[model samples]
Target: MTQPSREAIQTLVTQCLQEILNQRGTELSAPLTADTPMFGTGGLLDSIGIVTMIVDVEQTIAAEFNATVSLADDRAMSQRNSPYRSISALTDYILGQLSEGA
Candidate 1:
């Protein structure tokens, strides 16, 4: 597959987050965006929700990009700034992973 742009990855990440919120019957005061907090203070997701999102994202990426990625692996945990912190961070991390695999 051709390398995806940052916007493409961000869009995919946003869609996955929105889907997870919808599944949980959540209605946000604001739309989910690149700056939306994901797993920390004032975040949308709890531990379970984060886990669900991770699985959903990984599965969707595999289907969409035909590449398998482990989003919550050791490397992710060891990062100085967590990729799960926000949509933008997650998108960047995924983009890097895809690039490395390519």
Candidate 2:
């Protein structure tokens, strides 16, 4: 199987965020910044919502790249940084996984 491209990964992340926002449709006083936390204080994703995002990301990566990515695995989960923190962070993490698969 081939690795996922950076562009594809970015699209997936953006789609995940947008879908969640669409469902919740919250009245954000201000648009969320790139640095905004995603799973903690000021985080946009609740626990259940996080699962949805995760499933969507994984499935999209698999289908789009013809490769399987398990971000829930040991190395990813143990990282000093959390991929779920922000869109940029998640993009980098997905790219790293694709690189490893390559």
Best of the candidates, TM-score:
1
**Whole-model Cα lDDT of every candidate shown, in order:** 0.90, 0.76
Clashes of 2: 0
lDDT of 1 by residue, 1-102 (tens): 788889988988899899889999988998787999998788999999999999999999889888888899999988888999999999999998998988
- Checking candidate 2 for backbone clashes, the offending pairs are none
Q: Candidate 2 regions off by >4 Å?
A: 1-4
Give me the overall lDDT of model 1: 0.90
Stretches > 4 Å off in candidate 1: none
lDDT of 2 by residue, 1-102 (tens): 666566667767877777887888845666665556666567888888777887888898777777777867887667778888887788888888778778
Give lDDT: candidate 1, residue 39: 83
